[model samples]
Target chain A: MKKLWLLLLYGLLLTISSISLAEEESAFNWQFGVGLGVSHNRNLLPAMDSPRNGIPQLQLLFDFEYKNWFAETPSLRSGQLFGVRSGRLLDDFTLGYRLSNSERHNLALIMASYHDGFGYSVASGDGISSSKLEGLHNRESDFMPGLRYQFYTTDNQLLSLQVNKDITTHHGDMLRLFYGFRFEQHNWDLYFNSELSWYSAKLVNYYYGVTAAEVRSGRPQYQSGSGWRWHNGLVGVYPLNKHWITELGAGINWYTQAFTDSPLTRNNPEVVSFVLIRYVF
Target chain B: MFFRYRLLLLAASLFWQPAQAEALLSASPSNCVTLQQGRECHAQIQTAWTISQPLTVCLYLDEQQLQCWHNTASAQWQWHFKDMQSRQLILWQMTDSEQKLHVLATARIEVSWVQSAHKKRLWRRF
Candidate 1:
């Protein structure tokens, strides 16, 4: 599965590069920058809150669009630390191509990593862990391919829907719906985003379920069904000049009973907040 | 009837005379290019015009009048251009007796961007 994904990505890159060379009128737009930020986070697992506040972060900002193809790091999961490693260069990276493009509607095919898995020993150098997860098996992240549809009600308002299925691991599926509204005040650009996601039973169980063999005194074996998660955030961006920009945002994620009912999970919602400054080139 | 019409046409041709020469209007740096859409492009545009006879002339950007000259044969001015879309500059000859305006010449200033606003919004992040 990994090899197949790599092959697909390679083919996409080659196709885009060839198209770029053949078409001069199609402009290739890109932005690169570096950012420094401080964040506060709350993990989904219990007893894993060490060093959650005042965590300094270094970010590399890079995104590009060529004709109908694009690659970007979406800000939906920014500042959230899900202690799983997908072994990708950029967190929350998405590669997609628009199948249909118009003034009011857009449809695209995208490949991305939407969720991260956890291991039995959840301890990490960044200080997130829980004793209850010690006897569980390690869960692996999935690489999903999906379709995305976007509707623009106006220049400043957007609604998007995406559905993806895991092809690399677990064969689980996910669906996400997003709405964003943007407005400008003085020189500041502010955005309010709301997102809702639904995970299939296989996906939830693979990540949050506890097996009978790994049951402990207080950690009984539990299985999770399909679940929903909702997130809402407000972000503000101010350009200091032609090259410098500052951003600050805060958001919360609420998990449904399907996930919270699991013995390996916590009932409290997750909070993420950050402030960053970057220089664009 | 045909002979009478021919005579009238001959008299009219004999008395016909050419009207005034056409006015020439132009602007330097007629195109403004910006890196991003929805951002204003600024330019200092120098506009000039020449006419064969002295007449009351006024320059308009779209429908808004920018400057006017009184009984002038030629004139030039520097205009500070700031806008997000293309606009037309029209020179009109004003007749005092009729209080009517006639188009003399016109020029267009085009506004363009390297990236479209819609595409930028699709990938925007903070």
Candidate 2:
């Protein structure tokens, strides 16, 4: 399975040069900002309680183009890799060379980045019974090489397709399709994003499958197949003059049978929401 | 399963590029021409021209170029400066009847615009 994913990724990289080439533009432009927000996280484990935690948001936007070589952030939706709480702040960080960029449409980028994975350990007094989810090994982080294609339907709408293969440990692969729309009214800027993500069998099994050694009487050894996850959300930011802005967002996630059927997971969909206020500087 | 149709979708979208109007060679003042808050000193393009004719006198604002053509053998041509905007880059180009282009002159004015104390930047990624 890993070999197949590697082959596909290699093929994608080979086609980058044939796609739209990037135009040489000005260089070394960047933006920086900091903010804070509060999130209402939905606990994945039914026996455990989720927390309302305050999270800090920091952004460093720097991009430099020396001829065709370019490095910037990959535009990806924020998602939880393991259960509901385990997430990475730099999920969309990217370093790549632009294959092609045009004014009207079509952008092709080839990038390499670190892909995140999940690890769950039930400690004492953590409010969960580890015995029920025995033998579920940790999914270590891996470096992935990927191809991204973005279609700008307009200034306000976009469609993106990305395929990536993990090159380090588990060698799993993922393909995602995303659609985004932006609108502004009365000083409020609103953005809506919808995504469909497909994970390989190895990825699903490694993260959710129960091993034979750790399986108790109620926890049968299980193997999960490939699965799909759907997520949709809306984010709104209202800028008050030039220095202050307020942001709010909410999203829902639905896991397929491949993940929910596992003994370690529940059947309920997850809901995550947050609100933020920032002083832009 | 979504991967099955990716190539097909991409191929279709490649053909959907919208055509843009030709850019004009004319120039205008940015909203920031007024030295006040929320305004920056910049020149905006007003028209685009495909120069296919001979020109005698031309006018320029900032880096923007506007051309002119004269066909009559005897014509009275004179240049005029009508209330130039602040911090504007001005240039003039002349062309002979044989369609030879030449730079006539260039000049600039200085203007100060109010600067905001709060720093702000907005960007989007997809």
Itemize residue pairs with steric clashes in candidate 1.
none
lDDT of 1 by residue, B1-126 (tens): 999999999999999987865799998888776545787766789999999899988898998888988889999999888887889999988876524378899999987654457546433432
DockQ of each: 0.07, 0.06
Residues forming the 10-long window of minimal summed lDDT in candidate 2 chain B: B72-81
Question: Could you give candidate 2's per-residue lDDT for residues A185-224 as a string of tens digits?
Answer: 4345678888899989877776667778657676688898
Per-residue error at A200 for model 1, in Å? 1.2
Judged by whole-model lDDT over C-alpha atoms, candidate 2 comes out at: 0.52
Model 2: how far residue A230 lies from native, Å: 1.2
Which candidate number maximizes lDDT?
1
Cα RMSD over interface residues, candidate 2: 8.3
How high is the lDDT of residue A247 in model 1? Answer: 74
Among all windows of 10 consecutive residues in model 2 chain A, the one with the lowest summed lDDT is A75-84
